[model samples]
Target chain A: MALDKQFIGREYGPYRYTLGEEKMREFTLAVGGAKPGAGTPGEPPAHVSPLLYDEQAAKAGPHGGLIAFPSFAVVFAIRPFSAAIADPALNINMQMLVHGEQDLEFLDVMRPGDVMTTTGRIADLYERARMGFVIVTSESRNQHGTLVVKGTWSAIIRG
Target chain B: MPRTYQPGDTFTHVRECDRYRPIYYAGASGDYNPIHIDPEAGSAAGLNGNILQGLCTLGWVVEAIAGFVEDPGRVRRVKARFSRPVRPEDTITFQGRVTAVQDGRLTAEVSATNQRGEDVLKGAVVEAFIG
Candidate 1:
């Protein structure tokens, strides 16, 4: 089924998420990266640093909260795609899709305890010669309504 | 405390694009795009070759910073704009510089350049220096 052009510019909900340290560790491990732990005498892990949760160390930054891992925002930004694909109205088969491109802009750093709300919109939808493309843009804001991150995702729907 | 970095402080790491790496990233990221896996599908879509997922390249950048700080937690913020597609067999060199250090925070401009020296990703990363 072809994508409905009218869906373009349509906005989705302001879904909320809470950042957690364990989740970060899980994401890292799932990505084939090492988990943070104390180093041994001769061998140290390639990835994983406890500095993220050290209050004294992170307090050195402009924000006093624990510094988030660089790719932490991916957790929040990816939710909307599943929602869009699951919408019965769209009829998008998840298996027949490919992620074409993605871009993210961090306006500010978010702390571990920060409660963030993300609102997504179908920014663009088009098709070309049996292939379809959908672009979704999601903006995440902290509890104070401060913009934390803006994410753009493009999916290619194969016919 | 204001910290300034000289030109010689820059660091670079080159990575070979392994075909299987994209599948690994796809499983982790939940992005199953055929172009990243199926060569014929990618060619049919007008891609020069089976391209790597954008997040996979971002993951490399994350890996680069993770090596520098020795701890992923020290990174406060990271953002990047994907400018080009990364093809399989292409070697990408991750480059970074300490652009500024203000109020005890370190700001670095980082990028990934292909073997052709074309910029694939460009962005800034902010890290908290415990030292």
Candidate 2:
């Protein structure tokens, strides 16, 4: 069944999330190729910038504080796309769906203790080569109302 | 002082999808999709085995550029298509070439390949502020 085009403009959220220091480090190291074990997120990899894990080093660096890895925005910004796909109205076949593409634009750095609010809308729905494509666009703002991150997410549902 | 960048500058980064990485990434990213953490589910879905989260692979693209610019905070944009699944025990090598440097910003094209030399991402591009 084809996805209903009427759902294109449907909005997902004003989801809010509070950044945490340890969580940021854990994410950075996990993606940076670190090996995690009991009671630790693992050591930061040699190539990972200290700005993402070392508080003191980051504080002394240009940003003057610990900054989350750029893609960390996906943690909160993905809420809407996740919500849209899982929405019962869409009735998407979960097993046949795969993430197709992603685009993220970071307007400013994100720091721990910063409160982020995200909202997104179904941008488009179409069929290509017998497969369904669902596109969602999201915007995340900080406590001060600065647009910190923007994302375009696509999902392909196999026919 | 910020480092200068020019078109044609190249950088590389490599990562291995260790057996437990998907599970660890699931814990950290809140993406516990069974296909990424459960081999049984993956097999049922026709993947043969578990695969890494596409976003985790995207994160590596960010790392490649962040390392080049010397600051994670300077990464301005990253975009890519998931062309293939990255499975456990697979090693991915990312190579990036600076494509443009303009208006205090730099743009680069990145290619991600697995050990078999299959492309895992397509149209991968990253941009960062260098000034």
Candidate 3:
């Protein structure tokens, strides 16, 4: 069975998310971030992986305070889309669904403690050959209402 | 201090995909697709064994660029096409070069390959604000 083409442009979620510092640290370490204190012995050295640990990066970098990797926006923005697909209306065959391609465009940096809201929509739905494709685009906005990130997530399902 | 980046600068970072990468990424990113964490399920589904998530490999690419740029927030955009599945224990290498600097944005053309020299991410591009 083919997915409902009407689900295209169907919108879901202006979900709220507050970024956390601990999660940022954990994600950094899990992705093979530099182990701590590899800094110079005699010096009060600069912390490695400032992207995850350095407040100075906030001062010198784009966003301040304890920061996160660029991809953390996925965590903030993904929930609603996942919920949308699971709503049974789409009839997504879980066993046959495959992630096709993903991309992100950053308009503003997301920082820890920023209360972000994400809204997602089924951007496109179409069929080619025997496969059904759904493209979901989500936009995350920071507390200041700045559009922090916009991402497009594509899933291909067997028809 | 934010170091100035110029075009033609080059660097590389190598990551060894630990056995638990997919699991951790799954927990953190909320993509609990069984192919990434359950070996039996994946093998039953003909993947041979559990495979790492594609976005996790994309994370590695961002890490490499962050290390080079020295500021995670400076990264403005990242895009990649998953050309191959990344398995546990695979050593993935990312080589990047500053291809252009126009206005305040710096562009780097990045390429990713596994230890066997198989292309895992191709035509990858990253843009960051250098100003």
Highest TM-score against the true fold, candidate: 2
Q: What is the DockQ of each candidate?
A: 0.26, 0.91, 0.52
**Candidate that would win on lDDT:** 2
Q: Give the per-residue lDDT of model 1 (tens digit) for A7-90.
A: 877777779988776554444443433323333112213444444444676566445556665566777776776577566777
| Model 2 interface CAPRI class | high
> What's the distance in Å from true for residue B92, model 2?
0.6
- Residue runs of model 2 more than 4 Å from their true location after superposition: none
Q: What's the fnat for candidate 2, on a 0 to 1 scale?
A: 0.90
> Local error of candidate 2 at A62, Å?
0.4
Full ranking by lDDT: 2, 3, 1
Judged by DockQ cut-offs, the docking class of candidate 1 is acceptable
Candidate 2, residue B69: lDDT: 91
Question: What lDDT would candidate 3 get against the real structure?
Answer: 0.77
Q: Which residue segments of model 3 deviate by more than 4 Å?
A: A33-48, A54-64, B1-8
Candidate 2 structure quality by residue, lDDT tens digits, A90-115: 99988878899999999999999999
Residue B70 lDDT in model 2?
A: 91
* TM-score for each predicted model, relative to the true structure: 0.63, 0.98, 0.87
The number of the candidate with the highest DockQ is: 2
lDDT of each: 0.67, 0.95, 0.77
